[model samples]
Target: MLHHWYISHHHLYIPPSMTIHHHHHLLLLLILFLLTPPLSTSQNDTVSCPLNFDLLRRLVGSNRPSIDSSTVCRYAQQALRLVESDHLRRTSSFVPPPNTAESCWTAYQAVSDYFYPNFDLRRNCGFQTNWITVPGCMNITNRQQFENKISNSSLNAVVSACNQSLTGSSCSSCTVALSNLQASYLNGESVGNLTDCRAYPFIYAAAFINQLGPTDRGTAVCLFSLSINFSKSNNKHKTVIIVIVITVVIVIVLFGSAIGFWYSKRLKKLNRKRRKKAEINTVSALDSYTGSTTLIRYTIEDIKEATRNFSRDNIIGRGGYGNVYRGVLPDDTEVALKRFKNCSAAGDGSFAHEVEVIASVRHVNLVALRGYCTATTPFEGYQRIIVTDLVKNGSLHDHLFGSESLRANLSWPVRRKIALGMARGLAYLHYGVQPGIIHRDIKASNILIDENFEAKVADFGLAKFAPEGATHVSTRVAGTMGYVAPEYALYGQLTERSDVYSFGVVLLELLSGKKALLSLGDGQPVLLADWAWSMVRNNTPLEVIDGGMAECGPPEIMEKYVLVAVLSSHPQLYARPTMDQVLKMLDMDFPVPTIPERPMPLVAGIEDIERSVSSTGSAQLSTPRGYQAYTFEMDVRLASKEEEEGKC
Candidate 1:
């Protein structure tokens, strides 16, 4: 022993060379010293911090050799809570002291060493490759898994784990570990396998202890380490499996694309055959109606020449159904050609027959239908065309609220004349026709003006015939939203009064120089009819007149006209006047009627109106009075004006 000895300043001596057996003995002594817990001042004095054997036993039982990321996170959270609770209980305060992190780290290290004698924090826990790296692991499913694990754990196990992690010199390391574990859990970071317990073995143990409670601590430790080692060894196998899966996916995509292309081609051929059959049927129907003289059937070539192959420059109007283009015939007669898009030949042929009957309807205020053409082309497929007299001044909507040039030309007198003409035209459709035609859509856009500014009612596509003895037709509700009559819109009850209601809305628009639907910066949009009614009910009918129309007519005359508009647009089907009656009131042929108090049922908000209008194809309301009322209100102001002018 004295062969070589070294002495330190502290007076401790060590032999420079020792026997192998002696060296082994010295290592055992050092090991025993490190394993012993720190001593208290008195031999009988109990250590203030004791290991929570019950918690460790529970954690060991619950833990699986291999666990998912969610299970790891749940265990981590439980360990942190236990540590926090124990800290508060011992300190008698909720707030953690400054040395809390150090204490937590120390406790965590001690536990790790106790569980796995050869545990390496950096090599096992710090290596990123050892953990699962799935993207979006913090999503709903992961959170749900965490909740389930916690819910299934024993309460005692959770409390014991927390207490153990918060006590003794080991507390500093445990506290630090707990904080790290909590952060990782919240962010949905993955914990490695059992052997590589990810810096917090106590947390991992606490989570699964209930499930693995029967296993001895030594066996649990051995199993955890083995599982981690096995996982590490399978890295190459995982890479191979991933490559195979990617290759299979590429094959699937290629096969799907090829099959889709073949199916698409077959569909196109079938569609072509169907289109050809439809075209033949349409031609046969047209030949049967060739005797009708009202509509002149033009050749496809003639239409093409007239419309300049449907040039974009010639387009005057565009709508959901089709486009209207200006065309010049070989005879120098200019016409408006409406080319319907996405129409089948059978549909076009039926429409042409209807056009033949509508063409027979001749009136000064109605746009004349010149001819029609139905054909198939190589590039454009089936074509449906309706030719009418070209009106240079465009639609009434264009002049009333269109371009500046058009508005400038529509003087107050011109506007009044246009309004009167529109009334007379609608009157002709509702009363003059043999089987009365109800123009389904009667907005300003349908009323066209010629070069002379005369109103020509057009667009009879949506019109329906009012047969003899039928007060109302039960057809599909179709029209512009704001201008649709509540009776017809809500119930699809198409009566002559429906047209009357629409005309009333238009009349209000004329009086106010506003759109049929007016937005006043409020939540709900105001219908022109509703706004006019409100003004009249408030006894401020003069306020409803357009400012630009101040010089259009006298206040008394304008007020009377506004009253006529409101009375005609009354929401009740029975309350609205007939189109003929509307014309008479506007022309001063009949006295303006006293607008009755709007029926309580009609004073609904905009949402109610929309709901009623959209509830088409449902049960309809009963028919109201089919006859028009003759009773009128004698306005004192109008009577005075008449007295002075000597025209009453």
Candidate 2:
């Protein structure tokens, strides 16, 4: 009779066997029987064993007839007991086959040895280890691909690469890999933990387990469920489904939160922009516009041609509107063109207002306004064309101490005359006109001098229309950096005294022959007024005079000029001497001391300069002195007197 081996939920059964003596076959049967329970609990239905019959027939067919059925059956029973002893679950009762157990055991052993012992496998078996490992694990779904890579890499090297130590507390890389592993599984992506062998071993393991191949029996059971009760095996399907659903919910919540945060920030930015726009609009609406005489328009092309295409070479000076360019008209008359900035909307309005106010008011000491180009073009947005009479000697800054030659010629008498001319121009703006205009941005740069070295106050872009009803104009404050008064800069108050304060700074610059602000060796900023005030308070006022200036005049004259400048430049506006007070100072007399040449430190070629001027312009240097003047080297003279006068 043929023998058989049977496996069921209740037990493993070995049938009585025919005699066969094959050592390898006997060992195979023993191993298989050992892997299953000898006794079976009555959990399900039983079946007859076929292993006894198959083993007997194969042995006889191979001409091996020495094996005994009783011996095989006994070996199978012992192996089954050993396997059952290792299992954590209890054994159950089952029916035994009639054939010898040896035959069934041999058959079972052959199949078990074929698949199990050839590869390394690890079972967690209720341990705390991160993952379970399996070896020689053939895939039922993708067997060929897995086997190909297995031969390509050494077993230990592949294992070692995956089992690398994490080593550090910073686990951001590990966390990202874990997230990607989970996301890929949820997305139905092909993931194999061991196959990919990512840097993180555990993440790779998770993917591997997820994609593992089912056994042959598993495939049959799984396929049958498709036709039968597919939803019955919750363990086989529901775990992955739950993970996918949770992942989707998390992604949706995160996306919604990100969008909400972005919208909130965008709303705040929009609100801030709206508030700023409203503030600017209110200021523009409240701006007084009654003083404007007429509105004019000009193309950018026309203005460019007038000012040599806005060339740097043509820039005589700069103002709030833009650069003042020296240009000549088609009528052969010279014109001072004030080109307003293309980007400045507020400046455009002020430029128009200046043209109206300056064009109507005529004064000899103030720079004369002739014509304007209110240039408007589709390409340029807006442009201002201001035509004024050109002064030949550039600004007062240039003539005072600008060139080696000019400083030599800037004798005491000439400086006094320039001071008086500046006073007269300021007085006219302060009290001489219809509605006294304050030249808000008063500085050496704004004061133009003719070839004869007369001061002409210019740049009234910051000028305010002070009429009967207005006590103060609530407007944006504007002035040059060092010339700005502290109160005006802080409060945006427009008044005539603000102009006086800036003029005082200009006066201090004149007295010291230094720029209003200077950076010293230790990076300290020294304003000219503060430095001069220090000298004045120390009673060493002559120390503040320019080297070239010190030698050109007597100590007594220099002292008087220093006192006037210091009084004008006092920090408090009320403490400052007015232009009228300044004029009186120029006319006042003190006992003339034996005016000795004051000593001074050497500036660049100042010693040579003083030696030269003392010899040549000695006669011209003998007059009484006034406020000191800062100087520059750049000559801003227009070529001809007729051209200059015609432009004004």
Candidate 3:
């Protein structure tokens, strides 16, 4: 009886009612085929594959059992190495001969008979459609590429139309079965006039590999399959040996990878623990400086969200310390969020200083300390954040010496008002507060101004409080270069006078319309104070006055300003007027006493308040107020009245 058999993949499907005779014949053909390898360990010899049926029989020999002629032809067609790489190479090269169809058919049969039974073949090979057209097949260059497209493409949906149809094991089994079928065909196995089914798949796989360039990572998988060839009687043994070797190698790789992964994970966990411990230690130290106040921790997420995710568009300014971003609070109040460098050497201390000083202090002239946030939220990489009231109109430095348009617009009256406001702010910092806070850094930049030209002392990050009876504070020298006091800058001796000196520098900057550090040619560094002093000494001080001041204020008013600047910027610490003295000078409420003409007191107060002023004549207080004038006559009169009252 003649029967039709078609091999789709590795499966060898036979139709029902093929007859018991065919079944017996098929089983016998499988059992007695001389293509089977010997059990002995000695045979490692290579044998050529049969190009025809006569050659196939000659290879099987007389000791082999009877095998079907068609099966023989199929085996021969499927026995060649269609996909292979050099022994050392892991990647596969898919270069096909002119007759790709013949080779692919042989590959199909090889894989089919080798891995799967007839039933599996019947189910998968139900359709003999043009599975891999050149265009469709060549598109998949690598295994990963193929798997990716297949997952999203109709191939995956149609291949197993049902939901949850395949597990990992089942999928691997299917791949193996299909691979065997393809191998069988590529081996030159033929069925009737259909040529070999397996050879076509190999050609298809090869065509794809060719397009993906040699450097493609996926080509290794295709080459992996070609390393094993089953042709001689002992080929089965060789195949088994190779499979065992591959399995052992795979197991070793998997084991090593597992160990490596475990170590990496363990190291990561240890690092996390160490980092957590370090953070806890740091928080503990920071808390020591804070009293009765709970530090508000802000998660990185909270900060990002609060600052609109630290958007670059929201950035207001950048300083030596860190960038300042604009943030809107939950209540819709805008604030300037100063972010400190995470890895900065002084970030922790600076944060502590700002929080400690700003939290407890409240003053109108001082920038109101709103609130701050630390590592309070679950966001990543956000640790230190400080929120302060947003000062609009930018910094005082901007208005004093900003763009030409800005400077021209700042009237002399406004400039004087800003200077007065700044003085009051410093006065509050120096003595107005209960604990007497000293602003370590007092510069134009630190003085923020509002639209109304109201000066607010800002950036108290370096501020310190003077303890009772402490004349000077010993600290690490920290301040802007030019504004830093010579005493503190040279010898780390911080005192209220240091701020006086810095304020003096700012006053000079204000009057001169130039930075405190300026150059006037001749290699002479024209420090604002020295230049202004020289101008005053030469009586040409009006030339140094800001032109804006020149236009708005009276010439005489500018001369008084020159006097104020000279008094404010006295080189000697004792000579410099106190913040209170400066305020009085600005307001002109106190009289300008005549100097001694030779050597006079650097600081002259209201000692000669009631005395008349005369040029070149020294003023004296003959009987100052609150001094007792003892008179015996007035005492005797009071005693007589007392005696009379007692007698009555």
- Highest-scoring model, lDDT: 1
**Alpha-carbon lDDT, every model:** 0.58, 0.49, 0.53
Q: Between candidates 1 and 2, which one is better according to lDDT? A: 1
Two-way lDDT contest, 2 vs 3, winner: 3
Task: Report the Cα RMSD per candidate.
Answer: 28.9, 37.3, 39.8
Q: How does each model score on TM-score?
A: 0.51, 0.44, 0.47
lDDT of 3 by residue, 324-407 (tens): 898876778888887765432223555666777776666777887655665734544535777788998888688777787777
Model 2 misplaced regions, further than 4 Å: 1-305, 308-312, 318-320, 343-347, 399-403, 467-475, 519-521, 588-648
User: Tens digit of lDDT per residue, candidate 1, span 379-427?
Assistant: 8777778888999988878877987666777666777888889899999
| Model 1 per-residue lDDT at 145 | 47
- Return the candidate ranking by TM-score, descending: 1, 3, 2
Encode model 2's per-residue lDDT on 1-648: one tens digit a residue.
445655555454555453455445755776776777666465453333332223222211322212122123222222222222111012111112323233333444553333233221212112111111111122212323433444333323333322332211112123233334433332222232221222122222222321221111121111111000111335447689879989999999999997998799898878767645644553343233322433234455656777778889988876433577888766777777876564333344455567656865667789887656543357765455666788978886775548877666666666766777877888777678778787777878888878888888987766777665554454554566567554354345565666766776776666667877765576755557767776776789898777776345677777887777766665434345556667677666733212111211111122223333433211111111101111110011111321222221
Off by over 4 Å in 3: 1-299, 344-346, 376-382, 592-648
Clashes of each: 36, 45, 62
